[model samples]
Structure formats: structure tokens, C-alpha cells
Target chain A: MRDIFDQIRKRMQPPQWASWQTLIFLSIFSAATAALTSQAPPQIAERIISSLGWVFLILGTWWFVYEPDVKKKLKIYELFIGPWIVGALICIYLFGTWEGRAIPAPTAFVSWPPISAIVWSIPKFIQSDPKTKSPIYTTPTPANRQNIILVLLANLLISCWFQLYFEVQDWLAEYPSFRAQGFEQSAFVRELQPPEKRLELSRGVDYLDAAEKALKSQLEGKPWAEVERWLSNLDQEFPTVRDEAFAQLSRVAENQLWNLNARVISDAYDLEMRAIWQGPSARTAEYSLTKTCRISQARQVSTPEQLKFNSPTPPALSAQQIRSLGTVQCGAASSPDSLPQP
Target chain B: MFTDVLPLRAILFQLLFIVLAIAIESIVLQKYLGIGQKTSIQYAATANLASTVVGWLVFFTAESSLPPSWRVQLIGYIFYDRINSPALLIGLAFSIFIGTFLLKVQTINWLDQILGIRKPSTVEVQDPIKFRGRTAHRQTFSELPNRALGVLWANAASFSAITFLIAVRTILPPTNY
Candidate 1:
């Protein structure tokens, strides 16, 4: 084991081509740079990472290809490496962000490759031929130049396509109904809802249905003039219920706006008044008339109990309907406690 | 189920990755295969871009198929919203690396052919110097095993690097509240 260790140590000794001091310095610098960047703003960290990635690529290329075997440096630091690094940093500055914490850049992987080529091409670029001499740099030929442009165009096109795809996906999700009249809003609201939610939703639907039916039946054959009067009287009589009464009336109008079913809705004036009064609030007749109703004192009216006693006979209605109507407009049937007159 | 729609930030991140992967692959092609730098870049752009999209689709599929509890755990791991189970993270990493590797290889080959790089010469070449080295010979892409190994190595290296970077980010709590 000792002998093997000795052999490994001997083999691992620095090569003639490598500058040990420079390598150590660069490594430390890179580490320190990364550590410092860890706390920097995300944008700064991103740029630093991009730059460090390039630096690593440069070093890796040097260690693997140009240094040990060649026993000579590429020596194109000023002409190629420096400029490439600067250009790369600038590009990254413009395009890179750390917010996504995603893959840094497309060129990140290729950073070393281009640098390697440039290193190899330096000698060719600098002079007519350096075959007999040590090559320091690689040349960028016309073909290389054209290839660069084409590659750039290709990348741009791919980016545009990706952006388009992303936009389309977002659009589809944002307006799910764009595909078709998709499920109603209620369907979406109903997802993952508790078991009891079905009951609640049904109850809401029932209430809306009842309210709508009451509104339509009350406004079936009335003129707009009559509706206006009923609504105006409602506003004066029960200001709190007026908005709802008018809104429901408008819905009825709009529902039949362009249809043959459209008609000037009218109903019994007193019935309309009673329904509007009983529709939401169930105040006693005297309390409702005195405090809420806008009708004049000249109108001959009496409480349902008083009317029941005075009449010889009274109309019939179910207990539920009477409770719903909340008035004696249907005569004896509207009073649950009173016996029918013979 | 998680919404199929990707956030803008997430899409942008994928785009950035695609760009980086293409650039790196192009450089590798140029340096190792003697392909013109631009041609290599163009090939890389198409290959990497396709691979990125395919990778996301695969990831989405995996995520969607996973049980809801598992998906939530995975998403939690992804956002560092909670401490991640090592087992889950390892499994996720393995799947991601493998998925990316497979898609990348297939895409590269498909795009290479479509891009008219059907049979590039891969003549074995030695280093300029006759000395002891870690890697002495460069085999052409024509060698199927070598190509596979090369692609595997690249993908593994990239995946490991990214995983390490992400782990670091996870470990270091963001400075901003």
C-alpha cells in the first residue's frame, strides 16, 4: 500500500506545463468568489455563477488539452480568452437572472468548447502558418463566422417558439372557457367541496329559484307603467326592499326583452304591494301600513284578523302558501289560526 | 391535481436551461468532433431545445401520475417549502437525470439526422503529445457505445452539478424575507 501510495504521489506531481502557483491562486479566487456571491443579490449571484462557469471551463480545457501533453500555454489570453470571457459576461449580464434558479444559460455547457476552439485557432489567426512553431492561438475563419450567425438565428427562433408555447399554455389556463363554454362557474366552485356543500349549494339554488318564481308570478301581466308605480311605491313604502324589487323586475324585463314572450308585466296592485311587503319581511299589517306602506289613510284597509271577523266567508289556501304569502290577501286561508266561516 | 399550467417564472427558467444546454452542446461538438462551431451550435440548439420541452413533459407526466400526497411532497421539496425526505429527493434526482439523459440522446440523434449531420467521421485521434494522460484517445460519434457513454457522462455531470447547485440554494435560506 505504501509503495502504491508513493507511486501515485510521484505520478500526481505537477506537470512541466502547469503553473502550480497560478492554478492554486485561481482555485482559491474562484472559491472565495463563490462564497462571497452566495450572499449577494440573486442577479449578482447569477452573473457571478455564469462567469465562474466560464472560468472553470477555461481551466478544465487548459488542464485537459493544452497543458500537460503540449507542455506549452495557448498564450492567447489577450486576443481570445480575455475577449471571449468579457463578451460572455456581457451577454450573461443582459440575459441572465437568478430569480428562476433554473439552468443558467444555453451557452453555459458550451463555454469551454468555444474557448478550446479559439485557443487552438489562435496560431492560425495570428499568422500564415505556425506548424513548425508552437501554436498559441486559433483563427476564426469566414466559415466559422457564418456558422456563428446561423447558430444565433437558430437559437433566436427556438426561444421565440418556446415563448409562444408558454404564452399559449398560460392563455388556455387563464381563460379555460376559451375552448368551449366550459363548465359553469358553479362547477369550478364546487370542486373539492365538502359533502355538506352539496346541500348548501342546493339550498342556495332553491332560494334563488323561489325568489325568481315569486318575482315572475308577481310581475306576469303588469304594464311598465304599473311596474314603475309598484316599484316607486315600494321604494317609498319599504325603502330597504325597493332595490331588490326593482332589480328582479328589470331581470324579468331583460329576460323577455327581444322575445315574443316579452310582455308588459302587470298584477293586482294590492297583491303586488302585499307580495313586495311579504316577499322579504313579514311585519304585521298595522305595523307595515303605518311605518312602511306609503298608501294614504283614505284607502280602506284592515288587518287580516279584523277582515276575517267581518267577512261571512273567506278564501282557502294551504298553511305553507299562507306562511309564504304572510298576509290575508287570500282571505281565511291566509290566517292559519282562524276557523273558516260557514 | 396540480394545475397543468406552468407559472411564467417556471417557463422562463426552462427556457434559460434550454439556451444553456444548447450552447454547451454546440461547444462540445465543435471542440471534439471538428464540426464547424456554428453548425454545432445550430444542431445543439435544436437538440437541446427539443430535449428541454420533452424533459418538462416527462416531468409533468411523472408528477401527474404520482399520488396526490406524493406530488405535494415533491412540490414541497422543489420549492423548499418544507424539509424534504432524502429518499424522495434521491428518487426524484434519479428519475430526472435518467429522463433527461434518454430524451437528450434520442433528440440529439433525431435532430442530427434532420439537420443533415447523418454520418460525421469519428476517426480515432490521439493527443499531440505521447505522454501518460487520463483520456488518450478521442473516438468518433460513429461508435455507438462510445457515443452512449459520452452522452451518459455529459448528462450525469450536468445533472449532478445542477443538483448540487440546487441543494446549496435550498440549504442557504434566501436573504430576503
Candidate 2:
């Protein structure tokens, strides 16, 4: 080992031709691999190729540049490059799926660390006064800047291409639906209704309408305290009315208080109110009637519950009663609880 | 004297190793592990970027890649991805960047080790009154590249194990099947 080291020390230096040869070999290997695979290669193979490529490139360059004598050169090659070559063959045997059986194409550009390292080391090796404190050669120079730009562009292009390809496939798969109703409309509908059945369209529309009415009343200069009162009454009359009231308050506050930047704060308040009102029992008619009455009073009108009780049954109430009964079983026959008669 | 000129060969070897490592990682190791193409690609890209950038920075800085400030900043940024809604993509991106940077740093150090590149320890002339004088006194340490190599090997090993798991998953039919 000592003799080998001494010999390597004697012959250590790289030739220019070797760099070009290495690059060529890499290109060929990449091309051959891609040709054989005919598609994006597997992950493990790609990683091994990339890692081993870097290792060999650096080690080879080190040996070619630094090894002084033939004995040293041969020894270094045998120790490092030999194992790599054998490993490559074994890897091909173990992992190769295709008949041609070549390495996979490299997705990235072929630049390696040793070249950059050497470029960086030049200044350190050449400067007469090591203590002069000059900037290291690794500092980006015009050439390096050009290289960097090239690399950056290549990476961007590759990434963009990959992204676009996947997006195009997704779009293509959904194109028929999009074409029938337009992309915007389809997207809007889809966003409103994921397949999980979490959102109900009819309920959503009703909630939106209630929200709008509440906002309109607020814009007409109804005080927040009045709105809160009306919302609380509404909650007592209509248990599910909290979402609408909160939505309305948020919309009105957002539009009216644009100058105050209070929209976020108001929205947060509304969210908190909704959380409290929508608590477990909000599904009860008692909770609903109380909430609706509170909101109606905040709107500075006679409570909607009074009007509702005086009039024939509101269609909204009938629907709400039906929904509540769907889940609650009342007797041996699982009968729904009847709405209280005024 | 020969050591002065062997950079070309070293560069070639490094390039070869990187490519091979990526291939092995993606095809053999990742496959066995049950990692799909997307995840494997992500890992490859991140590792590549991390290794390259860190290698360049360290070789130039005369330092190792494990400085506290850098670790805090770069690794911290990676951890920040966890909070994102679609975390996988961002996580992959962050991991790739860090992995590649580390790989590059390791590669250079590895070369230094194999080639026995040593820097002579000598005191530099300094201005006694200047605050910058202390900067000259700091000795730049280059860690052995084997550490970085070890990390890469570990990654490969883990990936390979994953591939094996995936292979087992596929080969052995499910009880339902």
C-alpha cells in the first residue's frame, strides 16, 4: 500500500483528453440506457447510475491527474474503477429488465463534482502567496456564471416539461366533461361537490341566500349588536341558521369595513360564533327557533319566529324537520318527532 | 507533480459515480422498497442537488457541511414543508435539495480522502489591529469524503430494503387474493 501510494504520488496529474472521453462515455451510457428502457427508468437504477457516475468521474479524474507512475495509475484504476466496472455489470445482471440491458438515461445534465472542485482548487494551487487572501477560484466567474445559467435553464426546462406533461394528461382525461359545460363551470361544480357527499347543494344554496339577506340588512346600517341579537333569536328558531348568519356577517363586514382591515377579524369572530351556535344541539328545532329570532331582531324586525308561528308552516321548516327526523328514531317504529304546534 | 494534473480523471469518475448511484437508487433500491417513480425521482433530484451544492460550498469554504448555522437554515427550510397542504411535493423538493447538496460535499471530501490531499498548517501574516485579523487564524477543516459516502450508502441500503419490501408485497399474493 505504501509503495502504491508512493507510485501514485509520482504520476498524479490529469490529461485534458480524459475529461472529453469521460463526458462521451457518459452520454453514450445515458443514451443506451434510455434506448433500452424506452420509458422512464426505475428509481433504484436511476439512483445507482447517478451516484456511481459521480463517484467514478471524480475518482477517475483524481487518479488521472494525481497518479505519477504507471504502477500507481494501474493500481488506482484497479482499486477504484475496477470495482465500479464490475459493480455496473453485476447491477445490469441483477436489475436489467430489457434485452439490450444498458444503464438508464440520466434525466439531469452530466456535470460532476471533480471538475468543479478542480476549477476551485486551481487558485489555491497557483497563488504564490497562500496568505495573500485572494478569493477562491470557486467564486463564480464568467465561465462558471455561464455554466450556472445553462444548468439553471436546463433544470427549469426539464421540470417544466415534466409538470406540463402530467397536467396535460390530467386535463385530457377531464376534457370531455369540461367541453360539455366549460372548464370553469365544471371546476366550480366539482369544487362544490367532491364524491364524498360532504356537501349538499340544496342546503348550500339555502345557506347562501340566508347569508345574503343577513348581509343586505347589515349594509342597510344595522348595528353588529342588533345583528348578534337577531342571530341568537334565529338560532333558537332554526338550529342550522348559524352558518347563514355567520356567512352574512362576514360578507357585510368584509365589504363595509374594507377601510378598517377588520374583515379578517370579523370573519374570525363570525367563525367563533358559528362554532358555538353550531355546537352539538343546533340540530334541535328549539335551538333553531331561538337563533332565527335573535338574527331577525338584530335586523331590527319582529322576529321571524313570530311571523313563522303566525303563518302556515314555512317550506324551510318542513325540510329541516324532515332532515332532523332522518337521523333521530322516536319510538319502536322509529317515528320522527312531530314539530310543536303553536 | 502528477497529482497536480489528474483533475480531469477525477471529474470523470465523480460524474460516473453520481449517475450510477442515482440509477441504483431509483431502479433497484427504490423499487424493492415500494417507492414509485414519482417519489424516487424526487429523491434522486433532491439528493443530486444537495450533494452538488454542498460539495461546491464546502470544497470552496474549506469547511464541512455540518456547520450549525447552515444546518439550522437549510434543514429548517426543509422541515417547514410539513405545514403545507399538499406536503408530499414540497417535502420531496426540500429533501432533494438537501440530499443533493450533501452528496456534492461528500463527493469532494471523498476525493480528498482517496487522493490524500492535505493542506499544510501554517500561520498567515495578519494585521494586529484589524478585526479581520482573526479570520486568518481560523483553520479550515476538510472532513474525509468517506462520511458523505457513508450517507449515500445508507440511503442506498434503505432504498434497497424498501424495494425488497415492495417486491415481497407484489410477489406474495394477499390473503384476499
Candidate 3:
């Protein structure tokens, strides 16, 4: 409606500009804050610090620059948008910028640094009068429109600069191999050594080294527990490497002198365990080797339609109850004397 | 997927999007609202400008902030892996339509009041003696249906504009999405 346009025009026409000193200071502070926070680890402390910095920067800038009448506009803005900004900051803190395992991804676009440019520039745009001699808010001029647009463009550019830089920094952090390769290396140069080959070679070396160490320690008569612990300690494994590592460890355990092979059988939703000794062909004496085994959810074999593997312990066995309910007929042992179990 | 270099093309695309949106809304307003072309154009431009800036700003902010998992989920919901989900797209379109309709009505009412553009109405006394000359106006009631229809047309136009913008953005050179 004409009336709505008139009202808006009236409100915006005689825009007062914040002092140049305040504008300059605020812009510098915002960029600095963004740069600092980008360099810092994505932690709650950093989020909180950046948010508080923005909140104070806006308030402090307004206090130093604007007249009392103009300051009321800032108050209005604060009243309307303040709580949401703070809430967003709190959420950003709670959900640190990480990939998997974070609480439902909280958006960070409304955070302090990204929004600071617009918020700070709004008053500056309103107050700016480039046509005037001193550029102070004395009277509204026709050139005010052009000047305001310039100020807004400046604000947008400054804000975007911070955002782009921060984004690049985030990208660098996410891909640490870029750092390892060194920034001096061009993309074409880097492409000369394929990433897939690099990964394969590195993983191959790691696997060989780990296998050698485990086998040597085992030959020295280290307990099976030590080997198991060492295998488990290979954390931060890529999926392919993890599977390969697990397979290698299993092979080492199987080739041991006092080896125990355990089979987990699930029949009609009932789980049964059976152990067989496959080493030493001539032992007449019976030996019961107590072995501790880990039950992991089988990724390759299990499907949703079949028995689920989410539970840490099987359903057929209670925590306190341990009864060998299922019959386990031992296979013909290498020595007939050790084949007494049923 | 963005090249992480010259984003001039993206800004150009955004400008084209805004111009297209304004044109679509203006045409709808002229045809359905039964308003003059000039007034319709003015209204369309104002409304589109306000909404587009706010909408794109919020959208970019959310896009930049979303985690990979959430982004994947959102992409799945909206595009269904490029097969497209009509249900989701329509739902989003309708939501935006309703929001825009309400905002337009409020702005129009305010503008009319400020410009002293009230429609003249006869005041018919409902009950002269008991209700102290309480009156009723029939003009507003009669005009309601026409206004509602006009708004519905506006909604359709807006939906089309949004869909076009989405398609263009999707088909364009990839951003850092």
C-alpha cells in the first residue's frame, strides 16, 4: 500500500550515520574476532568468547557513536533479536563444529561474526551522508540513498571477507593431509602422487609393522591378552584398514601353539558357543585353557531381517546365569585322550 | 562443489533470480488482484525484494552451518537423490506462500491506512434504539472472496518463482555445497 511505503520511506529517509570512528573500529574488531575464532579449536569456549565479543562490540560501538535518540533504534533491535542470537551462540557451543557423533547439527550461520557486519552496518548506512561536507547527520540529502548503498556494500564485502577466510580455514582443518603435503605444492604437483596409492602404501606399511611386532612379541612368550590389547589399541583406523587389521590379528591368534577356535551358533534365535583345540597331535593329558573372547557386532554378515547384533550380550544368556544348555559334542581330537567333552 | 574462486557468477544468478521473481509476482498481481499494472508492479517489487533478501540470507546461513549428516538428510528429503520429492517441494512452497500472503495483507493494510486510501462505506444501523446506532459495513465482506482469490493466485505465482529459482540454482555450476 502507498501508506506502508510512505511510512517505511519516512522512517528510513532521514537516516543518521554512526560515527566513522565507531564504524572503523567495529569492522576491524569483527574481522579480528572472526580470524581469532577461526584459528582456535571449535570448542564451547571459543563460541562463547566470540559471541560475547560480538554482543559487546555492537553495544560498545553504538554507545560511542550514536546520539541518544538514534540509540533507541539499537535498543529496539536488541530487544527483538538479542535472545535468539544468544540462544544460537549457546547452541553453537553445545554442538561444536564436528562431523559424526555430534548432537543434531546446529546451524552456525546466525552466529556472531557472520551477522556482525550486517547489524553494525545497518546504523552506519542509516547515518551515512557522503554528500555532506563533514558527512555528519545534519539534514537528509538526495545523495543519501547512493551513500547508504555504498555503506551497505562495504558492510557486505567486509562480512563476506571474514566468512570466506573462515570457511577456507575450516576446509584446511578438515583436510589435514593438505597440510602434510605442504602449501607450497601446487594442485597439479600434488596430483602427480595419487591419494589412493599414498593411502594404500601407508596402510600397507602400518599393517606389516604391526604384524611383525605382534608376532615377535608372541614368539617371546607374551600372553595372548597382551597381543589382543595391542590389536585393540590401533584406534583411529580407516574402515578398510580396520577390517584388514582385525583379520591379521585373528590369523596370528589362530596360528598360536595353544590355539582355541570358538564358534558362535544361532539356531532358532538361540545362541550356542563351542570351542575346539586344533594344536598338538600327541598330548594324552587334558588341559582346560581359559580364553576370553570379544563378541562384536558382525558388520559383514548381520542383516536387519536376521538376528540383530545390537546387544552387548546375547539374549539366551542372562548376566548372572551361566548354564551350558546346548550339547557340544567335541570333534575327534588329534589325540583321543583329550576328546572327553560332550 | 564450488570452485572456491570467483563467485561473481553466483551473484549474477541471484540477481537474475530476483528479477524473475519480481516479474512473475507482478504479472500475477495484475491479473488476479485486478489492480493496475503500475501498482501491481510496485507492490510485487517491494514484497519480492523484502522476502528474497530475508529468505536467501537465512538460507545461506543455514547452508553454511549445517553438518554433513544434516546436509545429506536435507538433500535426501528435498531431492530424494535427484529423483525429486514433489510432496516436500509442494509443502515448502505452500508454507512460503502462506507466510508471504499474511505479510502482504499486513503491509497493504498498513500502507492503505498511512496513505488515507480507505474505501467509503455506508453505515447501516443494526439496532437503532438498543445498540446506540451500531452499524455494519457490507463492502468488506463482499470484497473478501475476491481478495482471497487474488492471494491464492499470488501464492501460485510465488510457488512457480521459487521452483524456478531452485531449479536454476541446482542446475547451475556447483557451489561449495
Who wins the DockQ comparison?
1
Candidate 1 per-residue lDDT over residues A1-342, each given as its tens digit? 999998987776555545543454465566666666656456577567556755654554454443343343423543334334433443443445334565444444234334334444443455444567654455456555434434443444444444433443443342221222111121011112223222221112222333334444554344444555645565443433333434444222112111110112243333322211111111123111111111111222234543355555453321122211221121111111122436
Docking band of candidate 2: incorrect
Candidate 1 lDDT over B1-177, as tens digits, reads 122333333444455555666666666656555567666666566556556655555655665587644644443333223434567657866877787777767766765554445445333333324644534433222332344455666565555555665567557744321
Number of backbone collisions per candidate, in order? 17, 152, 7
Arranged by DockQ with the best first, the candidates are 1, 2, 3
* True lDDT of residue B142, candidate 3: 54
Give the distance in Å from residue B166's predicted Cα in candidate 1 to where it truly belongs: 1.8
**Model 3 chain B: lowest-lDDT 10 consecutive positions:** B119-128
Sorted into a CAPRI-style docking class, model 1 comes out as: incorrect
DockQ of each: 0.02, 0.01, 0.01
- Among all windows of 10 consecutive residues in model 2 chain B, the one with the lowest summed lDDT is B1-10
DockQ of structure 3:
0.01
Error of 2 at B73 (Å): 21
lDDT score, residue A251, model 1? 29
Clashing pairs in 3: A3-B111, A4-B111, A15-A126, A16-A127, A17-A127, A17-A128, B2-B175
For all candidates in order, state the fraction of native interface contacts they contain: 0.01, 0.00, 0.00
Docking class of 3: incorrect
Candidate 2: segments with Cα more than 4 A from true spot: A1-16, A34-43, A50-232, A235-342, B1-177
Candidates in order have lDDT scores of 0.42, 0.35, 0.42
Candidate 3 wrong stretches, greater than 4 Å: A1-240, A243-342, B1-10, B34-38, B57-68, B75-86, B110-148, B161-177
